[model samples]
Target chain A: MNESNSPRLDRQDLGKIALVSLRAARMIMESGGRAQVIAKSAQTVACGLGAEFLGLRIGYASLAISLGDDANMITRMVVVGRHGVNHRLDQAVRRVVQRITTERMTPGEVEVELDRIAQTTPKHPPLFVAAATGLACAGFGRLLGVDWLAFVPILLASTLGQHARHYLLGKQMNPCVAAAMVAFGCALISSQGAKLAGSDTVNLAMIASCLLLVPGVPATNAQTDIMDGHPTMGSARAVSVLMIMIFATAGIWLAGAILGVHP
Target chain B: MIEAVEHLAHQAFFGGVAAAGFGILFNFGTRDLLWCFAAGAIALGLRTLGLDAGWSLEAASFVAAACLSVCVAGFLHPRLDPAPDMIALTGCIPMVPGAFLAQAILGLFALTSPNPDKEITTVVLSVEYLLRVAFTICAIGTGLAVPLHILKLMNFRGSAAE
Candidate 1:
C-alpha cells in the first residue's frame, strides 16, 4: 500500500515528457500528420497511467481532451491548439499549471503528463493556413489595386470566427463555416481589389493564389502514409481529416456560389 | 569571382528566409536556422560551380546542413538549446516546388485553348515536386540523427579520457 502511495510523477520526469511531447508535436506537423493524431497519441501514452479516454473537441482554436478513470473520476485538458502571440500562450500556461495543481501531482509528474499530452496532440495547421491565406490575399489585393491592409482584418476575422463556429457547432459544423468564411473573405477582397485597380487581374490572381491555401497538401500526406506502410493508423487519420477538409471546402464554395462570385 | 559571390549571396539570403519560414512553421530551432543558412550558402556555391544534377546537389546540401547543425548544437548544447525544427524546415524550404503547384493549377483552370499535354506536364511536375520535398526531408532528418549520435560518442570518449 505504501509502495502504491508513492508519487506517480516527479519534476524531472515531467520535463522529459514535455520535451519529448514538444518534439513529437513538431515531428507530427513536419511529417504532415493530422490534428486528431495528437489527441489519439496522447491517449495512447496516457493509457499506461490507466487514464480512460472520454472525448476530444476543438473549442475556439483550443483543443480539449476529456479523460476519466475506471472509478469515474474525470479530468479535462484544454490545450492551445494553434500558435498565437497572446491567448494561446496564456491558455497553455494555464492548462499546465492546472494539471500540476489539480492532480495533486508533483511538478515533474505534471510536466511529464503535459509533455505527453502536447506530443500526442496533432499539429495545428490553421495557424499556418491563416498566415498563408493572409499572404495570398495581400498579394492578390496588390494585383487588384485594392488596399492590402483591408484583407488583413478579413483574414483575422475569418480565422477567429471559424474557431467560434467550430466550438458552437462542434466538428460537424466546421465544413460549413470554413467554406462560408473562405468564400466570403475571398469575394470581398477580390471585389474590393477589382474596384481599386480597375482590373480583373487582381480578382483572378487572388482566386488562383487562394488554391494554395487548401488543405490538400496534408491530405496527400495522409495518402502517402498509407502508401508508405502505416495503413491502419494512416487510413483512420486520413478519412477523418479528409472529411473535415471536404466540409470546409464545401462551406467556402457554397458561400462563393451563393454570393454569385465566380472565377 | 565577384559575380559568383554576389549570386551565391543572393541565393543564400532568399534561401535562408524561405528555410527560416519553413522552420518557424514547423517549429524548428535557432541552430537549425544557422545550419540551414550555412548549408544553403554552401549548396549555392556548389551549384554555381556547375554541379547541376538535381538529386546530387539536393542530397549533398541536406546532408551538409544536418551534420553541421548537429555538431554545432552538440558543441553548444545547454547554452544554445538550438531548435532543430527551425533549421531543418528552413534548410529545405528553398527547394520546395511552389512554382510547380502554381503552374499545375493554372493549366487546369485556363479557359481558352486548353492543352492536355501542358496540363499533364504541370501535374507531373507538381507530383515530382512533392516527392522531392518528402525525400529531402527524410534525408535531412537522417543526416541530423546520425551526426548527433556520432557527436555523443566523441563526447563520451573525451570525458572518459579526461
Candidate 2:
C-alpha cells in the first residue's frame, strides 16, 4: 500500500509494533547477528508494521528501541539473555523480517512468530556435536603438525572434552569455568594417550585436542563488530574471548604440570 | 608435483572436516555445514598453495581468506540464504593460532615463577608467539571485512536506487 492508502496507526498500535520489533531485534542480537544487521532488522520490522521511525540502540547485553515521532514515541528496552549462536533462530528471524517487509503481518502474528523462533532448540544432539568436535579437532591436530599416530588421542580427547563441556553447560555452570575444566581434562587425557603411543607430538596433541574450547564464534564476531562500527559490542566480545583464552590456558598449564609435560 | 598435490589435498580434506565440525557447534544446519566444509577446504587449499610458494603464514592466511570472502560475496551470496560471513569466518577456523596463543599464555604464566633469570628467553618467545597470534587474527579479520564492506556498499547503492 502507498502512503495515502496506509491505515493510520494510533500510539497503542505503534507501541505493539515497537514491542514486536524489539523482540525481533533482541532475538537477532542474542543469536549472534552483527550490530548493523540487528539495527537494520529492527527498523525494517518497525517500518513494515506502520511505524514511521525506529530509534534503535544495540548493546552487547541489551537492546533498546523507540517508536514514533518525538513527543508521541514509545520506547522499550530488554536485557538479552545468554548470547550464543543459533542458526535456526537466526534464519527464522530473517524470515520473519522478510515476511514483515513483503507481506502485511499483524503485531500479534509477529509476536507469535518471534515466540516460535525463541523456542527453537539445538539442531544437533549432544552426541552428534561431540562426534563432530572429535573429528574437527583431529583435523585441526593434523593441520597443527600432529602425526598420524597422535590423531586418535586428539580425537578421543576432544570428543570427551566436548561431552564434559556439554554436561557442565547443561548443569548451568559458568561457560568459562566449564571451558577451563574441559581444556584441562582434554589436555591431561591427550597427553597421556600420546605418551602411551610413544608419540613425540604430545604437546601438539594436547594443544589440538582442547581447541574445541577456543571461542571461535565470539572472536570472529568481535572483529566483525569492531570493524563494522559497533565498538561497544565488539569490545565486550573481545574481552570475553580473552577471558576464555586465559582460563583455558590456565587449565592446560595445570594439566601439563601434573603430566610432567612442559612445552 | 603429484606428492605436493597429495599433501595439499590431504590438508584440504582435513580443513573441510574441521569446518564441518565447527559448523555443527555453531548451530548450522546440514546444508550450511556442507557450505562450511567447502569454504574450509577451499581456504586451506589456497593457504597451502601460498605457503608452498614461500609466503609468510600471516600473508598466506590473509590472501586465502580474502579470496574466500570475495568468492562468497561475488558468487555465492545471491544463491545462498545464510550470511556469507558465517561460511567464510567458520572456514577460517582451521587457521586459528590456538597453539601459539596457548604457548604465549603459558610462557607468561611461567614468568611468575621463582626463576627471574630463566624467564628472559620465555618472555621473548611469549612475545613472539603473542605477536604472531595478534597479526594472524588481524589479517584474517581484515581479509574478511574488506569484501564485506564492498558488498554492503553495493547493496546500499542498489537499494538506494530503488
Candidate 3:
C-alpha cells in the first residue's frame, strides 16, 4: 500500500519511463522502424508507464512525445541518431517493448537491455554482406534467364559495387551520390565483361550489377509513408528515391560514354 | 498448364533465392532468411498468375506486393523483427525493374546524344521504357503500402489506453 501511495516515488518512476520510452522510440527509428511503428510503440511505452493519454509526432529524423494526464504530464523530444537497418537490434527493441508492457520491466531494466542490444554487432558479418551481394546479383541473372556466361561479370560487379557502397556510406557520403558512384563503378567493371565476351553478356551483367544499386527500401518507405497518412514524408522519400535513380542512370551513362558501350 | 506451372515454380525458386541473398546484405537475422524466401516466392508467383490472367504488369505487381506485405506484416514480422519492411523490401528485390531501368537509361542516352541522326525507333522505344519503369516503381510502392495500412489500422492503435 505504501508503494502505491508514494506519489513522489511514482513521479520519479514515471519520469524514468518517459525518458526511456522516448529513447526507445529513437532507437526504433534509427534501426529502420518507420514513423508509424515509432508512433505506435512510443504510445504503448507511455501507456504501460501509466499515462492516461499519449501524443506522438514522428519526423524524418526526430520524434516528439508527450505522456500522462494534463497537469502531471511529461514531454520529451529525441533526435534519432543513426539510420541503418539492423534487424537484430530491431528485434531487441521489440523485445524490450514487449517485456515492459507484458512482464512489467522497470525503466532501469529496459535501459540495460537497450544498451546491450546497441553493443551487439550485426549478426551478419561484413564478409557475408559482400558475398551475398554477389550471389544475389548472380541469382537475379539466372532468374532473368540470362546466359550462364554472365555470372562471372555479375559476381564481380555486384561485390565491387557493394563494397563501394559500404565504404561510401561509412564515409558519410550522401546516399544519392553513393548510389551513383557505386552504379558507375559497377557498369564500368561490367562493361569489361562485355568487351571480353559479347553484347548479350554485357547486357546481362549490366542489368544484374545495377540491380545491386536499386533503392528498394526508400521506394517501399515512400509507399508505406503515404498510406500511413504522412504524405509529406512519403513524397520526400519518393523524390529522394527518384533522385537516386536519376543519379544512378547518370553513372551508367557516364560509364557507357567512357567505355563507348551504348545499350 | 504444366508448362506454366513449371515456369512459375522456376520463377519462385530463383526469386526466393535472390531475395534471401539480398536479405543477408540487409543484415536480416539468419532465421528470417527463410521468411524472405517465402515472401519472394509468393509475391512472384501471384504476380505471374495475375499476368497470365491478362492483368497489366502494374496491377499484377500491386496485388503481389499486397500479398507480400500481408505475409510480412501480418504473419512473418510478428514472430521476427518489429520492422516488417526490412524483409519485405528485400523480398521485392527480385521484382525490381533491373532490365527496364537499363533499357530506359539506354533509350535516354540515345535520345540525349548530340548526334541528330539517332533513329526515330530509338526515341519511341526509350519513351516506352521510361514510362514503364516509372509505372513499375509506383506499382511496387503502392502495392507494398496498401496492405501495410490495413494491418496498422487493425493492430497498431498506438496507446494502450485506446
Candidate 4:
C-alpha cells in the first residue's frame, strides 16, 4: 500500500548527470554541432536519470522537450520548459535536490550515454568555410595590390573576433556588447596589421572575413519568428540582433579611427 | 573531348561534395545535399551553355537552383521536412562573393590619403564594390526564399483543407 508519491534522485547521481550534461555541451559546441543534433545527444545522455533532452536556441527561451522512456520511473520529472534565466536557475537547483535524494546510477552508464551522444553530434564546417574564404581573400588582396604580409593581420583579427563572440555568448553576455567587442577587436587587430605589414591586404582580409560574423541569419530568423506569429519573441530577438550588429559595426568604425585608419 | 568532360565532371563533383558536406555539417539531411548538388550541377551546365551575360548569368543560375530546390522540397515534404538551412546555405555557396568582398576592402586602403580627388574615386569604387556584393547576397537569399515561401503557403493551405 503506497500512500506517498515523491520523486527521488541521488545527489551523487545528479552531480554525475550534470557533469555529463556539461561535458556533452562542451563537446557539441566545440564540434559545431547543430541544434537538432545537440538536442538529440542531450536527450540520449540524460536518459539514465529518466530525464529528457530539450532543444536550445540562441536565446534562452523556446526550449523544446521530448519525454524520455521509462514512464513512472520517478514521481515527477522537473522539465525546465520555455522560460527565462530565472526558470533555468530554479530548475537547476531543483534538479540538484532531486538527484541527491534518489538512488545512484553507475558512472559507466552515464559515460556510455555521453559517448553515444557525442558520436551523433555533427561537426561544424564553419572553420573550414572561414579558412577557405580567408585563403581566397588573400589571393584576391594580392591581385588588388595588397602585400602578402597583410594577410596575417586579417587572419588573426577575423579568427580572434569569431572566438571572442563565441566566448561572450557562452558567458551569457549581452548580444550587442559581444558583437561590438568582437568587431572592435577585429578592427583593432587589422589596423595594427596594416601598420606592421605596411600593406592593406591584411585589413582587407580581416574586414571581409568579419562580415561573415554579422548577425544576418539571426536577423532573418527574427523575421521568420514574426511571420510565424510570435510577435513579442520575434521583436525581442530582432531588436537584440540589430543592436548587436550596430555595436559590432560601431566597434569596427571606432577602432579604425583610433588606429588612424581612414574610413 | 572525353577527357575534358571528365575533368569538368570531376570539378563539379568536388564542388558538389564540398557543398553537400557543408550541408551535413549544418545538420541538413540527405535531401538538402541532393538539391544543392543539383543546383551546382545546373549552374555548371548553364555556364557551359554560354550564358555569360555578366550578372544575369549569376542571377539565372541562382534562380534556377533555388526553384529546383523548391520543387525538390515540395516533392519530398511528404517524406521529411528537409533542413532549409542546408539547402539554402549550400545552394548559395557557388555565388558567394569571396573575391569581390576581399578586393573591395583592399580598394578602401588604396585610396590616396593626401589627394582628395584620388581618394574620392577610390571610396566610390569601394562603395560600388560593396553594393555589388550586397546585391549578390540578397539575390541568392531572395531567390531561395520566394520559392520556398510559395511551397510553404501551398502546404499550409493543404493542411488547412485536410
Candidate 5:
C-alpha cells in the first residue's frame, strides 16, 4: 500500500500496532523462532505501520525495536520469557503479519486478532504430554538397542518423571529445578531396572528416561544465532542449555548417590 | 542389502516415534508432527547407517544433523515456512547426548573417594566421557547449522533469512 494513498491511522493506532507487533515478535522469540525469522516478522509489522526506519537489537532475553516515520518514532522493548517451542503459536503470529499486510486491517482489528490468538488453548492436555514423554523415551530406548525388559523400565520411569515435571511446571516452578527433581525421580525408578537380574544394560534405561528433559531446541538455536552474527545472544542461550544439562545430570547423580545404584 | 535397508527403516521408525514426542511437547500441530517425525527418522537412520559403515561417531552425528537441516529447510520449509526451524529443532531432540552427559556427571561422584587409584580412574573416565559429550554436542550444532549456512550462501530464503 502506498504511504500517500493509505488510510491514515491515528498516532494511537500506530502505537497499538507497534505494541501488538512487538508482543508477536516476543512470542515468536520465546517460542524458539531464530533471530532471522523474528526480524522478518517484526520488520513486517513496522513497515506495515508505515514506519520509514526500523532498528532492531535482539539480546539474550530481550529485544528492542524502534519504528519511526519522518517525525514520530516509537521504540518498544520486549522481555522474552521462558521458551516453550510451540510451532502452532509461531505460525499464528506469522499469519497475523501476512493478514495485516494483505487485508490492510486497522491496528484495533490487529490487536483484537492477536488477543484471540493468545487466548487459543493448547490442543493437548498435560496428561497427554506426560504420556507422550513416556512414549518418546521408550522409542529412544529401543533405538539404543535396549530390549523389552529394559524398555519397560524406561517407559515407566519416564512417565513418572514426566508427570512430576508437568505438575511442577504447572505450579510455576523453575524449569531447571523441575528438571533436576524429575531426573532424580527418573533415575531412582530406573535403578530398579538395574536390580532386576538381567543381561540388559540398565544404565541405558536410566539415561534414556532423562532424554525428554534435554534442551535440544535451545542448543540448536544457540548455534544458529551465533553463526548468523548474533554471538552474544547465541552464547547466552548456549550457556543456558549447558546449565540445564548439568542440572539434569546432577539430579541423576544425586539419585545414584542416595539409591546406591552403581550405574 | 535388503536387510540393511529394513534395519534402517526400523531404526528410522523409532527415531520418528522419539521425535514425535518432542513434537507433542512443542505443541506442533498434527501435520507438523508427522513431518518432524519423518525428518528425524531419516536423519537418525542415516547416522546409524554411517556408523554401521564404520564412520566415526562425530562424523556420523554431524552428517545426520546436516541432513536434518537440509530436509527441514529444503523440503519442509516451503510447506511450513513461517515456522521452519520448529520441525528440525524438535526432531534433533532424540539425538542429544543425554547418556554421555549423565555418565560425565556420574563420573564426577568418583572425586569424593579417598582412594587415589579410584580417583585416577574416575578422572580418566570422566575426561573421556566429557570429551565425547562435548564432541557430540558440537557435532549436533555444527551439523544442523552447516546446511542452513549453505542455503544462506545460495540465497534460498525459504525458511530462514527470508
Candidate 6:
C-alpha cells in the first residue's frame, strides 16, 4: 500500500523510493532532457509512490533527490553519465512516469522499467542512419547552391563520416576526438573527391560534408535552458558545444590546408 | 511569381528532409519523424515567404520558430505529444546557418596566420558573420522560449483548476 493511504513509511522504504526517483531523474538527464523536465519527472515518480515531499536538485553531471513523508526521509545522489540525444529513450521515460502516476506502479516495478528503457536501442540501425545523414547533408548542399553533379561527394562524404562517428563512438572514443577525426576525413574526401569527379562545387561540398558533426541540438538546447532558468546546466551544454565545434573546426582547417583548399 | 513559388517549395521540401534526417539521427520514432518532417516544411516555408517579403534572415527565422512552437503547442495533445521543444529544435536545424558559421571560423583562422598584410576586410567580415550567427540563434531561442513558457503556464493553470 502507498504511504499516503497506509502506515507511515520507514527510513528503508523512503530510501528505496528516493533511489528509484533518483534513477528516473538520472535517466532523463542523461538523455538530454531539459532541467525542468527532469525535475518534474523525478517529482512525479516520488509523489506517485506516496511521498509527501520531494526535494530534487539537478546539475550537469549528477542529480540528488530527497523523498519523505513526515519524520522519515532519504537523500541520494548519483553521478550521471554523458548526455546525448535519445528521443525514444526520453519518450519511454515519460511513458513510465505516466504509468507510475496513473497505474500506481511499485518502486521496484519502476526500477525494472527504467532499466529496460535504458537498454532500449536506437530506432534505426547504423547504416540507415548513415544513409539518412548523407542524404540530409546533400540536401543541405543543394540548398547552399551546390550543383547536382557535385552533390554526390557531399552525400558520400557525410555518409562515411556518420558511419565512422558511429563506429568510433561504439568503441568508446571521446566524442570530441571522434568529431574532429570524422570532420577531417569528410572534408578531405569532399574537397579532393569533388575535384576528381570534375565537380565545380568543391568548396560547397567540403563545407556541407561536415555538417553532420555540428552540435545544433545541444547548442539550441543551451539557450533554451538558460532562458528557462537552468543557467548552470545551460552553460555546461554551451561549453561542450563550443569544445566540439572548436575541435571539428580545427580538423577541417587542417584537412583544407593539406588539400590546398581555402574555406 | 510561379518560379518564386517553385523555388520556395523546393527549398521547403529539402528543409523537411533535413529535419527528418536529423530526427532519425536523434532517435525519434516513425510517427514523431513524420511530425518532424511536417514541422520542418512549415518552418522553412514560412521563412522563405518571410524572406520573399523582405524580412532579414534573423527576423524570418524568429518568425518561423515562433510559429512552429505555437503550432506544436496548439495542435498536439499535451499528454500525447512527444517533446514539443525537440520538434521545434529539429525543425529549426535547417536554419542553423552552418555555412556562415564555417565562414566565420575560417576568417578567424585567417587572422591567426602569420601574414602581417592580413586585410581589415578579414576582421570585418568575420565579425559580421559571427554577429549574424549570434543574433539568429538568439532569435530562435527567444522565439521558442516565449511560446513554450505560455504553454507551461496554461498547463499549470489547468492543473491548478483541477
Question: What is the lDDT of every predicted structure here?
Answer: 0.41, 0.84, 0.73, 0.47, 0.76, 0.82
Give the per-residue lDDT digits (tens) of candidate 5, residues A130-172.
Answer: 8887889989888877777777778788988988987898799
TM-score of chain A of 3: 0.86
- Tell me how far the alpha carbon of residue A250 in candidate 1 is from the true structure, in angstroms, after superposition: 12
**Candidate 4 residue-wise lDDT, B75-157, digit = tens:** 64544332443344454454455445444655654553455457777788879877776565555555555666666522222
DockQ of 3: 0.56
Every model's DockQ, to 2 decimals?
A: 0.09, 0.65, 0.56, 0.09, 0.60, 0.61
Alpha carbon lDDT at A250, candidate 6: 79
Clashes of 1: 19
Clashes of 3: 0
Better of 5 and 6 by lDDT: 6
Better of 2 and 4 by TM-score: 2
Q: TM-score for candidate 4, please give it.
A: 0.48
lDDT of 1 by residue, B1-162 (tens): 787667556555545543443333343344444564554454344433433344464476455546544644455444323222223333433443333333333333332334445656656664664465445444544454455445542121222123
Tens-digit lDDT track of model 1 for A11-89: 3443343333333333333334334444434443343333444554422233444544433434343444322111122
Better of 3 and 6 by TM-score: 6
Q: Which ten residues in a row have the lowest lDDT in candidate 1 chain B?
A: B153-162
What's the count of clashing pairs in each model shown? 19, 0, 0, 9, 0, 0
lDDT of 3 by residue, B1-162 (tens): 999999889778878878888888767877889888887888788888888899987888878887888887777655644456666767886887767767776676676667845568888887887787678777887777677656663233232113
TM for every model, in the order presented, reads 0.44, 0.93, 0.84, 0.48, 0.89, 0.93
lDDT (C-alpha) at residue A85 in model 2: 75
Runs off by more than 4 Å, candidate 4: A1-152, A194-203, A223-237, B1-81, B90-141, B149-162
lDDT of 6 by residue, A1-263 (tens): 24555557788878878888888888877777778778878888888887755587778888889887778768888898878888888878877887886786778999999888777645788899999999888878877888887788888999999999999998989999998899999999888878888988888888888889888877787887787778998899888887787778777888989988885
Worst 10 residues of 6 chain A by lDDT: A1-10
Rank by TM-score, descending?
2, 6, 5, 3, 4, 1
Q: TM for chain B in all models?
A: 0.53, 0.89, 0.86, 0.64, 0.85, 0.89
Model 4, position A182, has a per-residue lDDT of: 76
lDDT of 2 at B55: 96
TM-score of chain B of 4: 0.64
Q: Poorest 10 consecutive residues of model 3 chain A by lDDT?
A: A1-10
lDDT of 2 at B143: 84
